[model samples]
Target: MADDKYYTLAEGCPFANNASAVLMRGKQGSGLGLLQDTQLIETLAHFSRERIPERVVHAKAVGSYGEFEATRDCSDFTSASFLNKVGKKTPVLQRVSTVGPESGSADTSRDVHGWAMKFYTDEGNQDFVFNNTPVFFIRDPLKFPSLNRSHKRHPQTHLPDANMFWDFHVGNPEGIHQLLILFSDRGTPKSVRYMHSYSGHTYKFTKPDGSFKYAKIHVKTQQGVENLSSQEATRIAGEDPDFMIRDMFEAIERGEYPTWNIYVQLMSPEEAENYKWNIFDMTKVWSHTEFPLQQIGRLTMNRNPQNYFADIEQAAFSPSTMVPGIAASADPVLQARLFAYPDAARYRLGVNYQQLPTNAAKAQVYCPFQRDGAMRFDDNYGGDPNYVGSWIKPTKFYQDAKGIRASALALHTDHEKWVGEVSAYTSEITDDDFVQPAALWEVLGRVSGQQDRVIENLVGSLTGVKYPELRRAVYSLFGRVNNNLGFMLQERTEAVIKTVQN
Candidate 1:
């Protein structure tokens, strides 16, 4: 017996299997299409509206379904159920993408990669919107748009402008560390499976008692770190624009699952007060020697999405999608992202985007207050009061394992007492900012030919800057990182510029 179902219209009205168009035929075998063909009209209309808005950044990505297994209990640090017991597992969706590139852009482009993961836990959904690098371009929230714009196309030229890129970095010198790393081999990972990821912003892992410790999450690739050189990446981009995406998909298809060890560098509030660098600074990394990496879990991607557009493309993640016991810190850039990410999702997908299958929480949710938006499919909390504090239908609330209502928890120990005073504030450049980049430079030098590769990559891009002043400013910016780096960039960049001019 045939098991196949007959193909039909979207509304389930089955039509005869025949030529789609209804045409008025003449004796000469010529025909004019009739306007009454519902099938043809519907197909065209749906095709026109097929695509949703692509992400402004990290537009191109490879996603996978995975499991995060708790390797070590973290009950002392966080009461998050997913990490509270050994051998416990949580379902996860992972997406790794190149920043500043469109959906059709080359996967091997020299750029930062975004590593976003969503954990479907018992409490709710938790998202780790991370980066391959441990630090970011800027720490200040206000510079976010400017930083992205500088990396994107020039308004008038509609092309990537090296002058704009260099000028922004030179002006905002705190990004030197990230720039140096970006120009290095690490910027071009061989595949998404081979690169490590980090939570660039410090987060808080709170216990049930309202006590929390600052944390920077790190996920080291079990497949090991593998990167492509500038020449190799360029060749791959020309040869196979979707190289990384294909690599991941084929690997999973062959049962070669990619895995990562999750760890966190944790610091107490008391320790953060005396730390050398500000814990909230997104541009700086917490030293492993100082805080130390504590193992939490292991993540393994074992499944591929059956449909990319529905399962991966529509999936939304935000830093604000925190479960109980895991929360955001006071990092300015992180604070901005918490708002920006959800807002962008609402605009790109819809206000009801969370109702989509991929983005919905596995745990039960009861937010009647968030009802009645575009594409709202569920019952709008039938007969239940939308507003809070209704005596007629009092809503049930959750309590922790200790039987204490989460809402009644004491104020956080790190909460600041305010005096109703406000002042204008902006992060200023200081010698401290360059300290990490200089150290990273020295570390790069320790690897054979790594420093030269960095210099070559810098010169390759820096040579595109038509303005001599901008080139000089970039050299000065590097000089702050290391005198040798500054000299090499200046000499190599100018030599290339002159050769190109001649």
Candidate 2:
């Protein structure tokens, strides 16, 4: 070990030739030395334990610190203190990620984009874990894990199987809405700064007295929605896997801060009852015409994190972590996620994951009973009882807003029957599913070479499907979207695969 050159136990050393130390001779038993054996064991030990557990989903991401300032008053919908006054500003930690991909996957991969934000409001932390797409693959929570698993590498093959991905979508036809969005150019965002974000899940804006209005949030990027073609995305993936991550870091460093216009779509409880589609359904979007977006605020990412792992990797967010004015909806997918997210953080980090610096709230969090777990950095609620129901120590409200008023509520009748069973109920392919997709197809056609590229990109995936039935199901699904699209896709796939084999 030299002073100038760092010491290596043969384990951490950057050796030019590791195999040179091994004893190889015709008559090794004559003069074998044990000194040469120690180096091999040390090298093997270090290599074995290098990896940690990967995230279940949304592993590939880029994050930033930003400020959200209210542009107008939204007091009618919710008594949330943050939105009560004009020009109110709150610090936000935003993370954008690609869903269903490994941490090493390309930023421009064809996948659903995540836009998870944690607002450090005065009341507490408000988490908005949303996707770039307005709608989701499935409305039911039961379909979630399966949907993610299908997108992941196949258990047996250890490869991304096309059959698995298409099977899940075709079987759960409700995914048709999101599947269309996925195949579109929007799937491959040009840059993290150039893409828009959305609050796909319907949340409620409530008042102090427990009354609320259903709302959906949108964060449109000021830079505009820019996308890379499939060829460009593939080239960048090969050239620079961390292209989007590096782009954001350099942009912020150069003081070209990215900003988003925040908008909300509000609907009263009375209106939801008569709405055409289920308001609680994550797969369905509230018609923009019916529930127009209203300007609310602006979010600008001005600062970069000092440390990537501490600030980004350790950050945890959940839709359940709502403040006074913001609350969860009865949406089945959202309701299920409320429990799943925090539980995931607990398992991934620890029971007291929130105690971590990035996840911790600015507001005082006093829960004595939840003390003393692995990595419990804080004092275990000194001199206080671990169990609840102590007469002397009464529980206190999380926030106290004197002037904040509760929202007006519509009449409520006990309709417990609506709370239905969770089953494998696929979506019916009505004409409605194709309407938006058709409009999108026309837009693609407007762009030179885009229609041909769309077909080429889709066929590249479709041709890899091993199962004939699954392939036809996919063709049939697209056929419902447009007869011409179905025929073109089938013809293109067959021809491309044939050329490769020949």
Candidate 3:
């Protein structure tokens, strides 16, 4: 019977033994082995290649399968077929991960979480690669790699250096708003299931008639936001490194799946033309009061992976995997990601990474030219013409789209050409950047002990800084946000540092 089966080789051939391999050796195993066994060689070779390259940032993650159901018609906003009709369901694969850790790092580490969703829609795969925080540390695309590297370990020490982290932030105080939020409770989410995700960069919702609007996506957790304190997170990180992943799996096994309500804040071209802040800035968030959230769909994660390595590990999500009617805004960071992410995946996986079952789109793709790469999957379009405009056996083309540019796919900027003097787009901190952060501080003050909690949390982490100058600069940066909060943070942090030093 199939149930009463014994183990065999990968090719289904019966093996000599399952536990051990036969090896010819000299007497008393003191001399070199003269003969080599095929099974032993194959087993050792396969074992050496068992691991794949891990993700650079979000190396530790948990994946789940789900379905997204459109709850409201968004036809007026965009022509994307996935959101045009209510109750339409699309299969989704999602992975939530800790951003700044290795493959074996703890899930409860105090870091931002990467929230990625891949929608296998009829039009193709659309990937929404988001983060738990709405804002980021930098607005300039060039500084992205530097900001991430600063958060990582040092080259000389080979360990995470707090002085390096604070040095970067001190030099670029424009990240003060994101820094404040990161040191708060929100940064240490208790579970991925209980946290919301936001598209940090502005995107586009395009219409068929070449009209488009700037939009930002937000997905609020239906389970509501929950967080672990820094101390608690540290304890769990040491006690059970896989606590969050285990909890999510156990919750799903008990039929309590996690869900999030998807919404988008849209800005008309006219409104964007007159907006106070740059609409394309990734470090800023549009006020919800001005642009209310328009609910579109719901995402529910119901199934865990059958095979972690195949279904979860090999899954790839990139900003370039966009479908029709949904385009990217001219946000510099976003434009950089559109080029960077897919390239990184090609390096990690093979060039034909998209052909993997977990990454392939459910929609029909007929690109014959993108072929003959490493790990080539599929039939290579199966005897179809690889080149275009073949006279002997010409490939049929869509007459409407052939040589005709899709006008709606173009980015919708206010002016068609350059109207202002060309200058470098650099990030500089001013009193204006502090306004939002000050408002956030006041809002936190309203809640009993929330301000204290944030201050305490900041003080605790600030103790990691060994350099007094860097610590002092950190205080000054927060001082720009608020006079009292910064002074208090300095006082408390210095006191703690002194105590530990003594």
Candidate 4:
């Protein structure tokens, strides 16, 4: 009798009862394998094609399996089954990443961290493709490509160019708030476990009665917020590029799982109508004082992936993956991402990427219309009717919490009642754009040396810009936020440039 646990070939055949490679050996042990050795040929072939296309953005990341337990009944706010009752638990997958770095880049890089979570609910998968910050660089969907490209390597030099980075921001100064946050200590989070994640785009928390309220989701770390100083982050990047990833893994291994408290800031439709700032603006944050966070649930990461490639690397998440109770708002950036994220996944993974175990919905999925593509290993609906409205085997559609068929739900909302003629539109920077950043600078003053540290961080990157005029434009942009902030940045940056030139 053979041990069932013994190592075997991929097809479950014993490898001649030996673990050694089947190689043709000479007298002196010089060996060359023949192509007839199926094991050797198969191993080499698989090794050659092991890698898949890395994500264009957020290439470097760490992921873990988790569970979200609803602590408060949120049925009034949303009909999402996962949050319908207290103590309801849903399996979740979370991936935290640095947006601007390559897959091989240091984990401590000073960049916005992408915080994406997928909830495998009883209804379907609901994904929150969020960020560590509550705001983004650009609100206009048209500028999305330019914003990402500018932060990425220069096409001509194939290097990170500060000129390109500053030129884009200076031209589109609406990102000033996010820039201030990025330059602050918050940019260099101590680890994924210590940072809070926010849904920068407003989402709709809908009920079964055709009513909904605008919401911004927040996940606050239970371990408490911690940050690395600019100097410390740079040092860690040099000494241990995988610092954050290792910290998270070792902590979980020790049974000390990381946890986060989920909260949502809700606003009524009437309130959003007269809001001071555009609720749809990704660049703006809802005032916490007015729309206080309501406790929703808690998330705990208690399991680590057995295989990183199979679990984390292949997992695909998108804002479009919503269930019956939740839906997307008319925020232009959010609208664009609903299409871009899934499309990117299809290109990176295969068209049948959703069938991958990591991305597959835990609930029963029966969309025969979405049937075929390459790498589809499922039954592909078998003998069932692929087309809808068939009397032989009609497909069943999900219903809302109120027993209303989802298909019968209204397609339009009060927010979509714009009567203006269709025309091209671009967001322009205004005094309102700088108001929040100025307030943030003042907030930084509350903490000792925080404002100075931010200026130092700014100077560190801004000094790399070879063009003087571009640097000045950045200074002017910050100046609009705060006169003193602009002055310190200009003075310190110029001093650094002058010293280097001398």
Candidate with best TM-score: 1
Model 1 lDDT tens row, 1-502: 2457876778987767535577788998768876887788888899999999999999999999999999999999988889989999999999999989799999999999999999999888999999999999898889888998999999999999999998888888889889989998898899999999999899999986767888999999999999999999999999999999899999999999999999999999899989999989888988888888988999999999999998899999999999878888888889989999999999999999999999999997867679998999988778665666455434433223324233432234543343655765578789999999989999998989999999999998998899999999999889989998899899999988888889
Query: Clashing residue pairs in candidate 1, if any?
Result: none
Cα displacement (Å) at residue 449, model 4? 0.5
Clash count for each candidate, listed in order shown? 0, 2, 0, 0
Runs in model 2 with CA error above 4 Å? Answer: 1-52, 390-432, 442-449
Residue ranges of candidate 4 with Cα displaced over 4 Å: 1-3, 17-32, 390-418
- Clashing residue pairs, candidate 2? 207-406, 208-406
Clashing pairs in 3: none
Model 3 bad stretches (over 4 Å):
1-8, 25-36, 390-393, 396-423
lDDT of 2 by residue, 46-77 (tens): 67954445568999899999899999898887
Native-to-model Cα distance after best TM-score fit, residue 393 in candidate 4, in Å: 8.7
TM-score of each model, paired residue for residue:
0.95, 0.83, 0.93, 0.94
Q: State the lDDT of candidate 4 residue by residue for 254-372, as single tens digits.
A: 99999999999999989999999999999999899999999899999989999899899999999999987799998999999999989999999989999999999999776767887
Cα lDDT, all candidates: 0.89, 0.81, 0.86, 0.90
Ranking by lDDT: 4, 1, 3, 2
lDDT of 4: 0.90
- Give the per-residue lDDT of model 3 (tens digit) for 1-502: 3566777778776765877656555688655433455566778889999999999889999889999999988888787889989999999999999987898999998888999999999888999999999988888888877788888889999898888888989988878888878888887899989999999888988776777778999999999999998889999999999988898888888999999999999999889889887878777889999999989999999999999889989998999888777888888889989999899989998899999999999987767768888889678877655766566435555324354233443345342234578789878877788888898889778867878889998887789998888898899889888999989999999999889879
